[model samples]
Target: MLGIKTVFTEMLGIDYPIIGAPMFLVSYEELAVAVSRAGGLGTIPLPNYRTLADLKKALESIRKATDKPIGVNIHLSGKFPWKEQLALCLDYGVRFFLTALGDPRLIANEVHACGGKVFAGVVSLEQGLRARNCGVDGLVAVGAGGGGHCGSIPALILVPYLKEKVGLPVIAAGGISTGAQMAAAIAVGACAVIVGTRLIATSEARAAQAYKDAVIAAGPEDIVVTDRITGNPASWLAKSIEKVEKQPQLGSKRWLDIWSAGQSVAQVGEIKPAGEIIKDMAREYSEVCRCLKNTLVP
Candidate 1:
């Protein structure tokens, strides 16, 4: 097995250290299954769900896809009850969780009660430390290229910097797309990696074809950091940006009208299946590791 030798792999029961972030619209059971089958943890973002039953059904669907370890993402600040998801997770044996957008301490005790582990996302040293203090098992140190309400610095800086500041495992995200990039993340003190935009371009992404096309066609400069995507700061494709910029004269565009992610929007070129992408990244990483060891020793 291609083990990562890290807490992420150990806790999540996966081989690769990579994880599929809980992308709002694109993340679902299919994507999660594909990711898990490829040796990484997959996540379902539950903030978009309006009711407990909605989340319940989503979890059921995820179970239908794969029996491997899968994660559930929680918006800590939302009124939605974490208790509900927590109950379901325990009942269904879901243990790995990526908690974001609020206080990790708020839910840590409850999650741990269910024998679940938490990996919380942060943008700064302070935030990372806070999560540690709150008893998070690890950190998802979201950096510059991360999508959907992200941080300002690059992952390279954030991951290493946070590692020095805290004692927990770190999973770096934002702008990581390829196996080479995943290798770079681990080399920089990250124990694992989480990818969002890369999965967005995948065949199983639950997005409109036009949205997928827009992401593939985007360039770095074509992306815009817009607060309009949701009630938070997030990156958008230029088309979404233009639509926001045009701002619709007669009436305003609602949060529901925009597409969003982090600054990593331009890194992916095509949408393959999530399973395919995860498997390919792992295979490529294995090959690269072998090549590097041979070149260095010979």
Candidate 2:
């Protein structure tokens, strides 16, 4: 079994150091439940909910499926009515939150007041420090090669930097899709690895079949970072680029018509259930650790 202890695991009360990163539209009740049931943190992306009732229903569904702790991801932009959504989540008994896109200070304070843990998604050292100062419990250090909006730095450098500089548990996000990569993240100081693209290909994910197919067929070179989709730097398939190339205005384009995936898409060769994926990762993690341990001279 893959087991490790860190502030992240302790705070979330999860066994495995893996997080099914909240992806808009893709992350919903089923996927979250599967991840939580598999002993990893499962997160519902708030944007997937059209209203407070929708969010509550999803939360209820997740509760029905698993007894494990559940988390919600809220994009911290002015247009999202994030305060209202946060209050709704609190009412629904959500104790873990991951915020991105804007200042997390206000949200962190509110969540902290309610005894909830808040983790800020950051791409750069400056953002990590800012999140720490905002009283966030930890940081999701999303680096280049991550699926959505990500920083230019690689996790190889960013994870340790944030762990050393921020003095908090840092969850590495980017280009991680296998047990070896998970081990690599921990070796570099991350408390866990936030998986995005890998989960997209999972059975529980709500993404379209075509999107999942595209990801399954992709390679590292096929993942392109483009700002045209959400007006922020995010990784997407080359086909997504081609789809949006002729659109005169970004507003005229349909967001999900194309697909987003990280450089790790190459590692996702098959579509499996969310729980099975976690177990596979755990098995691979154990094997990798065992192999590495044999290399040491007594």
Candidate 3:
């Protein structure tokens, strides 16, 4: 179990606490199933399918691909039809639900009733606390370098703040790509690290090779934040974003125009299978712990 601290593993019904962050379009049932089967929690983005029938088919595909428990990522901005989407998730026997972009309290009860644990996404101390009050099992604090709709705070800062402000398990997000970074997050009170970009570059992802190519070509500086497209400051490839943000920026509602990626793009350099990435992260994490422990008998 890579990065599997007991806190998150038990809550999500997985061997590892490492969660594949919900990426729009890029994260599909195949990707999710791969991660879960590889020992980490895999997440299926709910809106990708668009309709109940499509969602049902996606869920069935996930089941056929892997027996590992999986989660469904829900957007609460009142954009996607969550009612229709959620019913499908329940029918699929999902054990976890991760709510993003809005209040998750209202969604928690439903998930819980279906025997699922809820991991509500939050960008601030206040939002995390609110979700905690709503009985969410955990909080995924998406930070400064996290893909779309990122937070103003840095993950290094957000993890600790969330641990203090809320009683639930805290999963840190942002530019976390290596075990050392994952170790740092855990040392700072994070139960697990939510990895996005690293997984994006993985072979199992549904993104175009060009997208992965862009991530490899980019450095941290290459990722620019522009509300010029999303209204909310989102970090993405500057070259691609420049063109998208310039179209009079008719709001981010036009998701097709802009793409999303986190700053970890600078740290990652190649594309491998999502399961391979998960396996490697887990292996590295264990090595990191072992290397650290070799130092002493205090």
Better of 1 and 2 by lDDT: 2
> Whole-model Cα lDDT per candidate?
0.79, 0.86, 0.81
Residue 239 displacement in candidate 1 (angstroms): 2.4
Best by lDDT: 2
Whose lDDT is higher: candidate 1's or candidate 3's? 3
Choose 2 or 3, whichever is better by TM-score.
2
On residues 28-136, what C-alpha lDDT tens digit does candidate 3 reach at each position? 9888988899888888788777788888889898878877888878887778888778787888788888887677776777887877888888899888878888788
In candidate 3, the residue pairs with backbone N, CA or C atoms under 3 Å apart (3 or more residues apart, or in different chains) clash, namely 203-272
Model 2: per-residue Cα lDDT over 63-180, one tens digit each: 7777788788987898788988998888777888998777778687788887789898889889888888888888888989999787799998999999899898898999988989
Backbone clash pairs for candidate 1 read 146-174, 146-262, 147-261, 147-262, 148-261, 148-262, 201-271, 203-272
Model 3 CA deviation exceeding 4 Å by range: 1-3, 244-257, 296-298
Candidate 1 regions with alpha-carbon error over 4 angstroms: 1-3, 228-231, 244-254, 294-298
What TM-score number comes out for model 3? Answer: 0.91
Candidate number of the best TM-score: 2
User: What is the clash count for each candidate, in the order shown?
Assistant: 8, 0, 1
In model 1, the number of clashes is 8
What ranking of all candidate models by lDDT puts the best one first? 2, 3, 1
